[model samples]
Target chain A: MTRAVTIIGLLLTVIIGAGTYWVSHEVERLEKRYAGIQSEILAEQESIHVLQAEWSYLNNPERIERLSQEYLSLAQIDTLQMASIDDLPENADQHLYRLDKFGEAVAFLPVPRTRPGDLMPDEAAEAMIIDAPSVANAGGNQ
Target chain B: MSFMRFSYWLRGDRPELRPEQRERLAIETARNRIFITGAMFFVGFTWISYGLLDASVLRQGNEPAVASGTDTRELKTERADIVDRNGILLATDLPTNSLYADARVVKDPVESADLLLTALPDLDRDTLIRHLSSRKAFVWLRRNLTPEQQYQVNSLGIPGLNFQREERRVYPHGRLFAHTLGFTDIDNNGIAGVEREFDNELRINNGPLQLSLDTRVQYALEEEVQKAMETYSAAGAAGLVMDVYTGEVIGMTSLPDFDPHRPGQAPADARFNRTTLGVYEMGSVFKLFNTAIALETGSANLNSVFDATEPLRIARFSIRDYHAENRWLTVPEILVHSSNIGSARMAMAFGGETQQKYLKKLGMLEKPEIELPEVGGPLLPHPWREINTMTISYGHGIAVTPLQVVNGISTIVNGGIRRPSTIVKQDGAPAGERVFSRKTSDLMRRLMRLVVTDGSGKKAEVAGYFLGGKTGTSEKLVNGRYVKNARMSTFVAAFPMQDPKYVVLVTLDEPKGTKETYGFATAGWVSAPAVGKVVTRIAPLLGIEPANAKAPEIEQALQIELRKGERKLASF
Candidate 1:
């Protein structure tokens, strides 16, 4: 019994010593990783601060107004152009169809269309269908 | 003999100790060893316990004490940013490098100065060389260097040259909000405007200080004011757009403004904030207050008529109508004609004390409460005589800031509630003190609408926004005398008058009469048109839908009934 007790005590001390060593080594590795992550965070924060400032500078109202005047042909919305929902006609869907038909003519004028569907209005589509042979002949001659 | 004794002891031939004496001696030695080990362990345990306690609690308490000692100076150097109501950055601190040199350590002062001069051509080469050769321990080379310039200087690799990290206050919008946001000094200290007003809060808080200014509205107001200034060839102009219910100033602009980035280079006039800092006798616009007070105190009603046929003389001072009609005028007609005589009569009915009490209640008697630090107090007539009442009723002999004028009109139109104006964004509708009854306020709104539809402010009428306002034209007072033909024209208006939301005021100082104006430089010809244009542009931006003119509700609320013969006079 004495021998057994003595052996067990010796084994416990060895196991505890090895466990302490492993834990200390693991802690050192994690500490290094934590330091690296902290530096990365600091760097990212600095870049974000710079980008925010640049974004504001680029989006200044004066500069945007000037650029819009130079490049865009849009006009301010007039009070007469606005209509309430109740002002819509009962056949609103038919009016939308007419607008869609108008959209087709606009597509052929070298203006970029906003969407892929409804490339041409009904009238333009019909005209294109009737002149399809002549247009092919002209293309052949060119 | 001693050598013989040592050899005997070594050989174990000395006289032997008795068994009991030997055992006792061994016990004494063992006991001494055990006692020493115990004492050492006790000392080691005590030290370990003390160290654990210090690490756990004592150090944490000490840490703040130590950090605060070193951090107070650092905290003053670091500042927070400022943003508009919509989170647009107005002011921020940019990390920059300031170049310095140790003159005592510089190896070749001439060569170093020459290189630095090339990098910073604006610096004087001789001055830099002198600084480099001064033999001082440290010297300032240049401040706020650009990154590219810093790189070029660093590439030169001159000895004794170093860089100290510094923060430079940058105003990205530059001159757009110069007077409102103000500017800081080189040491990042607040010196003027909102910066000076909220300096401590800005220093302690790392978050952005959000002001109530909307940049879009600010830009629009500034654009219109600039156009008006150019058209009229005015000396200066100021404008304000405020929310009547919340008392939040959405936009405020003063012409001849400077760039906050380089305030030192701007002239003093450019740095002056006219909206809050300059006080003027805002002429007939004060009549709006007079009429409201008259109705509120039951001194006059819509049917009450005052004879404006001739000038009324009071104490050697005669008040005459600018647009005089040779007959009696009703209360609405008085405001519509902008009759100074009629307004004075209305004030007389209410008496001088009531007028003073109403003006004080409307916050016109004190400096306006805005976030700007340069607020001008109202200049009141000291004697409080009867003539002062008559003159002040038509907006003369008493001077108030443009901010106060707008705030007072807002109170009259915004259900008679007086809310102190602020430049800080508020979360919800703020409660205000009731200055006039709601019925009186509604009546005032109808009378203001009449002015736009039929009277002097006809030029201020937009197509569908239902704008209502009064115009004020006062000659600029110069050295105790009014300068004729050098007029300060002002227009104060509120939109969608049935339920007013915003009050806008535009003032032009000394607008020159142009050929286009038919040689008329009054508020109707100059400032009223500017107000109309501003309303047209900003109404849509603010998402306020235009109402149909013939809408039954609006027509009923703003309609004016005229007798058969009075219709002809109403058209005037």
Candidate 2:
């Protein structure tokens, strides 16, 4: 009985020892992974900071103005073209463009300096304006 | 064995026991001791193993996750960023590689120095050679190398040459934001502007400091002001844009300005901040205050008339209007025509004591308390005599900074509330001191609008912005005497006259009249056109949707009864 008890005890000890060793090794691996993730976050944050500074530099008014003048021919928004929402046509279904809306494409696009202070052209980068489906198609679907 | 035998003797065995029994007892005792020792070892191992299991699985992420998550805002750069009102970065700290050398490790100092010189042509050859040849363990070569230069140095693969990480205070927009952001020294110490004012607070490591300045407005103001300076070839020029309600300085420009990155190389004159530091008699812009005071004190109304028929001579000085109406001008006509004789008579209607009290309440008698270290106090007359009052009625004998003038103008137009001007962005409009009555403010707005519609400020009138201002031309005082030809021509304007939003001031020093101006270098010509251009450019950026200035409501609101059935002024 004594020999059997001793053998059982020794077996339990070996099992516990192996389990402890495995669990500790796994913990170390997880710790290393945690450290790796932290460093990755740090590196990404640093890169993002650099990108923000670059964005500010790229969005400089003078630089953008120069680039726009070289590329686009935009005109200044004239005071006559400005209209309030109250001035818009009441029929919402109608595709009615107010003076300000009418002025947007021609005013901010493709015009050189018309007067002394009529300069600042914007970088309206070839916008992707998807058109709506035709009225006939909508009527048929309904 | 001896120790075991002594313990056995201490146990004291019976004499009747046989040899076999004695051996059995000894064996049992040894077995008991072994059992106890094994049990202790097992318990200790169990405790340690349980601790490991609990920590890795159960208590995981308790300590380290807190550390990592909390430090997200602690960025890699040592210095915090500074942004404008729109979150545009005005100033920032960028990482850089500083070149140092491990002098003891260098193989051939001569070859390394030659390679270094080739890579960086600006470095001194003799100094480089001596530094690299030093027997010390470390040596200094240079600091804050650009990325391209760092790459070149790294490619050289020169032994002992190393790069230590550092940071540089970079102003990406250069001279555009020089006087606002200021610049840091080589060690990243704040030297001037907002940087100097918020030095300690910045070092505490928080988010970017957002200033009240709008970058787009600032760019417009600076470019327009710079263009005006170059066009007329003036001595110096300054411009300011302030929010009429909140007293927030949205844009300020003082040319010629210097690049913050190279402040040392810039001339002393370029480094001087003219908008805040330089004080000047703001010409006839003072009439806005004079008219406001007259109406507020009930001394004069819109219909009250004063004589502008001739230049009034008082105490060896002649107060002459630049473009004299040469008639008995009403109060509205006095401001509309910018008549000095009328303004002086109007100030005399209310005494100098009342003028002093009003000016004092407008925050003009002291230095403008702003977020910048470079600010000047107003230069007031010593004795505050009667003659001083007449000249000061039209902006002379008292010199106030451009900042004060803009702030005071905002007070006169913005419901008569005087809020101290600030550079730091505010969450909302703070409380203000009431300097004049609402009725008085409304009347002043009408007079200002009337000035733009049918007076000397016609050049400043945009189509729908309804800009109104006063034309000021003061002979600059030089060596205790006013020079005739050299004049400080200035125009102070407020836009959207019905509900005045912003006040803009443009002043040029000694602007010469070009052929375009027809030999007229007065404020009406030199600075008024710039004000109009600035309003045209900035109005859109500020999101101020233009309204019909000729609307009957606006016209009636801003129209005044100058003479009986005159119909004198145009639409507001």
Candidate 3:
């Protein structure tokens, strides 16, 4: 009887030990996966930060204005310049074509050298550049 | 028998009824007890393992026994509202009931379809009849039903009739900004416009989508262009307004526009985006760029002169001026006069390769980089033969979209920075790619002003604000040939030309001359006046003070010079 009791106790102990080992292994694997998720989440958060900064940098109004003038050399146009065909020059070649340096074909416009102050701030510029009229509401040419 | 032999014999099978038998019985009892106890422990362990698993899954909400069907997921998200930049609701998702049926449970298919058609007269009875009679387990009777229809359908309550929740995309503004804002399909998928471009990002996020476009600006721009279209009896018109600094597209409209809500009903041509998508041979507008390119490359200066006395003929093609002055014209005069011969001569002087390089740098020889799905690729001449160079100098042999011209002009007037145009409201974006030299850009700005004040674009001017632009008139190509009667009239202009903040481009396709415009459908007659009206309307809204109303000092530098004699260079 005593021997029978010993065998039964040994079997019980083996079962419990095996179950414990299996559970511990599973738990370890889960913890590793959890850690991986945490790191990835951190990386995404960093990327968002970068994107926000990039957006702000790209849409700066002062910078864009500076660049526009530096590149296109366009000034505010005048009413006379925007006249109708009735007022057009008599000759077709008088307003027909011009040469381009890059050698590609292009239409031509005479340069307007009107200064900055002549422009009136339009909704197109105010709404586009800063996107907020309340903060920067000056309408006259800068 | 000896005592040992007797014991051995007694221990044998014959001793079962003796003391040995009693001992064996006790051992068997203990072994049975152990076996029972082990079985109980094993069973208990198994039960505990199963219980733990059940608890784990239940805690994680992964219970397999619970059936989570379509109804649950359907109720999770309310549809998002779509609004214009000015807080005008263009589209909205409203809660509506939809009819569904379990075909297996339906007893009378014909009767049910008849009842459904009565409740929703828009539905075709024959089609519904077939669908309801199908062997399929489930079928959709109707989607996006009105409350009244839902009630009527439910009252009939044919056993299989079921009401399901669904969303419908609604466009409140109808057709105003249809082509630009775009519309969602039946499944609420954005197939075009700003919606398609930013589809994934906009799906779950319901925050206001701030666009660069202004509703008022859009209205004004559209109204003027439409007026021009009607007056000139034109085929179509397209106009765009852009912020010079940030490259934000404020108002873009194309005639023959379709209502996004009813895109399928509109003709394909009306749905086309002429501003950013349609590549046209933009006529004399090319000359502006050509002149800028020349000045930028040190091939010429404002004081330099080109001989326009005779047309330059090469092979079979002749490059001549429509209005031949037959005399020497200075660099500025060539642009103001729009002298094709003079410009071509200057191009030959600069050489083909140099001109190609500069135009590419100015974002003219490629597709304009804008945040839209309908961008047109630049129509460049292959092999770039010498004839191509000559024709290109006068806005022929190559084609580009209106947006490219705007960007090109922006590069010139915005001090040579080729900022990529954007539709989304970027409070502060990065400095886009630099495409030109500042000096070249400045020189180009002066030339553009000369055109508007003393050149063909005089009609595009706004008195109070110094406006400068170039007018272009190109014959539309039809079936591999240029149609003589049809022309695309275009104007590109900037305000306060000295330091440009905005560029406005207007185009009319195949317009017929009206008596008011002196039988002329040229850009100076059609597009120029349209831009003028736009500038007049939006000027007040944009906070630009009228010239007479503005404080005095601000207008000090605004001058329109008409010089008859040679003017000496005033050194900066």
Candidate 4:
């Protein structure tokens, strides 16, 4: 009985020794991986710094102006052509009827635009609610 | 017990085995085996304990370090970047490696120098060889290597050659922001302009500095002024755009501007910041102040008349109008015709003390209030004499920088409040001290508009903008005398004049007569058209809506009466 207990105790000691060694080796590997990730972060930051400088160089205003002049057909927006929607003449029929400074008639169909940013908070919420019911209707049919 | 057992095992006499003696022998043998087993267990526990103590307390496992390399050093820039109000980059620092020779390790100096010359031809061979041959531990071979050049040198792999990590200040817009952002030295120290103004903060802060200047507006101003300078053949040109209420300088440009990246290669004339550093007699632009001061002091009203029938004679000097009106002129007409005699008489009515006090309040007599080191103070006459005040009334005798004029005009039109002009962006207008009553500013605005409509500044009129301005043509002083042909033509204007929101000033130094100008080099001919062009282009960019110039409200706001309200000033 004494021999059997002694043998069992020796076997357990060997097993614990192997387990401790395996854990220490695993810890070393994880430490190495942590170091690699730290270095990679440093490298990414350096590249980003360089790219920012390059981006500014390419986005030069003088160059962009020249390129626009060469390639683009769009001209600068005139102040007369811009007016807040509220400043536009209120037409009960939602028709375009405008008179310029010369008292000459100019007409164009006023395209109704529904921009999210232009909507008031309450109006935007109402729009979302209306959209949700349509989606629910499709789901119910499916 | 251990010693006694050992002795018994090595007993002095041997014993013959009896029944009890034999039993005793077996028990003794068993007890000895147990003792041996206990000793083995104690030894095993001591070994395990020593191992645990060593691992946890006695000896620490060395942590693997983030390897020492260039990546670690390049993580931070030495100086912060500079950007416009729109977050457009104007000046920035890029990581670069400077070549240095560990001279002690260099084996073949001549060969290495030859190879380095192939890559960097700008470096002097003699100096490089000498640096490489030195016995010292380190010697600088070249500074600020471009990435391509650095790659070439690294590929060469010559012994003792290494790169010391460094940063270089780069202005990618080239000459666009030369006088504003300035440049830095090789050691990355700010040398001038905003770079110099906030050098200490830039070195420590990680975020880019945002200036009040708009890059788009700056480019527009520069391009227009450059074209005008070429067309008029002016010696140089300078201009600025200021927010009337906030005193924030949106765009400013001085012609013959140098590239900030290669400041050393630029000529001295190109390096000079004319807007802030060069002081000049700003000609008739000062009459705007005179009119405002006259109204503010209650010495003159729109209908108050000063005689322009003949040149006003002062001791050893005669002040004459550039265009002789040769008649009695109302106060508004005085500014309209730029009548020197009438302006002098108006100045005398207020006297020298009041003129000095008002100009001081406008910040005209002090150094330019800006964020540039290259700035000059106004050249005021030594004594506050009556003649000095008279000459200054028509923008002569005293000299001031263009920055002062823009700021002063902003003060007059911005509800008669004086705020310091700043190159740093502000979220809102700063609180300013009241210099003149709001009513005086309103009258001044109306009178200035009349100048654009019916006076010498008719060429500056933009149909829908109600542009108002005063044209100034002053003869350049040469050899102690004013030369007639060599003139500095200047026009200072504010747009949508009913409630003036912007002040734009354009000055041409020694502009010659052009064929298109009908052989006239006056401010009305040379600079007024440029001011008009600038306003028309920049107004839309500045988000100002165009209103009909003939609209009833605008017409009423800009209307002024002449000859005691009997007749209104008429526009042709």
Q: What fnat does each of the candidate structures reach?
A: 0.18, 0.26, 0.04, 0.26
Question: What would the per-residue lDDT of candidate 4 be over residues B278-325, giving only the tens digit for each residue?
Answer: 888888989999989999999998777777778999899899886687
Docking class of 2: incorrect
Q: Candidate 4, which segments miss by more than 4 Å at Cα? A: A1-32, A76-142, B1-75, B102-114, B121-139, B478-481, B562-572
Candidate 1 structure quality by residue, lDDT tens digits, B55-146: 99788766654223221122232678888889998888888899999999998889988877777889898899999999998888889998
Which residue pairs clash within candidate 1? Answer: A101-A121, A104-A120, A104-A121
What lDDT tens digits, residue by residue, belong to model 1 across residues A36-121? 76667766776776677778888788899899889999766777776677655666444443224546522222333122112236
Global local distance difference test of model 3? 0.74
TM-score of each model, paired residue for residue = 0.81, 0.83, 0.65, 0.78
Q: What TM-score does prediction 3 earn?
A: 0.65
Better of 3 and 4 by lDDT: 4
Off by over 4 Å in 3: A1-142, B1-92, B102-119, B125-137, B151-159, B204-208, B436-440, B549-572
* Candidate numbers, best lDDT first, in rank order: 2, 1, 4, 3
The alpha-carbon lDDT assigned to residue B32 of candidate 2 equals 83
Residue-level lDDT for A11 in candidate 2: 100
Candidate 1 chain A lowest-lDDT run of ten: A110-119
Assess the local accuracy of residue B263 in candidate 1 as a C-alpha lDDT between 0 and 100: 92
lDDT of 3 by residue, B1-572 (tens): 57866875554423336787867866776787799999999999999988998898656665567444332212122334455455555455555678888888888989888777777889888888888888677788777877788888888878877888776665554566877877778887878887787777567755646787876677778878888888888898899888888888888899978878678888999989888889999988999888877877788876676777788899898888866778878887887888888888888888899888888877777778887788889888889989888889889988999988887887788877777888766676448666667877776776777787667877776766667888899899987699986999998888766667778888999988765555667787778878877887776656654443144543333333433323334511
Clash counts per candidate, in order, are 3, 4, 92, 0
